[model samples]
Target: MSSSGIWQPANDFRRVVFWRHGRTLWNAEQRFQGQADIELDDVGRAQADKAAALLAAVGPARLVSSDLRRAKATAQALADLTGLDISTDPRLRETYAGSWQGLTFEQIADDYPTDLLRWERDDISVRAGGGETRIEVAERMRDGVLEALSGVESGETLIVATHGGAARVAIARLMGLPYEYWGTLSGLSNCNWSVLQETGNARNPGAEGSWKLTEHNAGTLPEPQTEPVED
Candidate 1:
């Protein structure tokens, strides 16, 4: 695992499990719920429960999540199953959608087509009214991931619950993918889980160790399920 400070991996450690929070009321409405703090829908709750079950099977050592309600709720479910404490960090929150919050894609396109188009083009500087720019979102998310990894020892596994946009940006930054292609990747399904591994020198890290995408869009659990929310 790469090290920027005193934290050194006991081994060539680098593995992270990225889980997208379950469906939300906004998600059901096909709206841009960035940083809006919406709760998960019933299906979303079920998704979180299923995610917890799957994660329990793998047994992660640590659990981290965005401070948003959706993400926190999802993390809690996993925490309950694995007996790991859930930690919240604002840096992991979803991309800020500014004035676009609660608006569906069709609405945004109808009202802010030019702005929407610019976003689609991956303009890092473009801001949707009160929303954050792509660059700003990327920086915060990078910091959050690094911070979360700092506390982990080499070979220790971590589970992070986050939003769709944030998850995409985080993975893009980690893999050194170009920002322009950020929107090209497949959208993470609600409650879907992805895995990444960290490796390399304690002082420096590279993506060369072993990074793989595990389960994606795994379905919901049965009744009385727990779920996650955005931070």
Candidate 2:
């Protein structure tokens, strides 16, 4: 009902639920998985199912997801549960790790210690060899989130699935956290979901608005136990 022809703002306004994709083989390996196209592991599939069930409980009107296989797979599970088709956006993809794509953290530390240390210190512009800078990742993620918000009218609920680092950037920006504190934020678990609320006057979509983080890294289902069970 707004100018964009999207649904009109109800008194309740809109909410966004951001979900991190389920676990992958690389995740189990504790590898830097950026931009790598690994599929979900068996446990990851169960995680996706749990996430979908969780989103269904909240009842979002639309589902949006990163175009990457891991994210899409996770989003699709939720979409199927909620009977909503997913709208994929490549902009939501994870930060490109470049040369570090398939390497483990320990390996990166050993091979690129200085870069790793700088990154840990929150250098927004630091780049791993052939990798993306934090600034670049933030900018694209911010633009993608803002664009998604603009497309929907006030009061519409949206669900988005993306990667850990990208999720961190998006959440930090939405909550107005300091750029340096990006590391302070908790890492998102596979299939975990976070809820954010947006408020603004429907008359002016671009007008000053308030965004709040209602939930942070909450999962619909329990994480698969990595520890071995005792007999």
* Candidate 2 global TM-score: 0.85
lDDT of 1: 0.71
Clash count in backbone of candidate 2? 1
Q: Estimated TM-score per prediction?
A: 0.83, 0.85
Q: Which RMSD values do the candidates have, in order? A: 6.9, 6.7
Q: Count the backbone clashes (under 3 Å) in each candidate.
A: 20, 1
Q: What stretches of model 1 exceed 4 Å from their correct place?
A: 1-12, 199-203, 206-231
The weakest ten consecutive residues by lDDT in model 1 span 222-231
lDDT of 1 at 139: 78
For candidate 2, write residues 121-184 as lDDT tens digits: 7688788556887767767876777777766665677788888778776767766667877777
lDDT of 2: 0.73
Off by over 4 Å in 2: 1-11, 200-209, 220-231
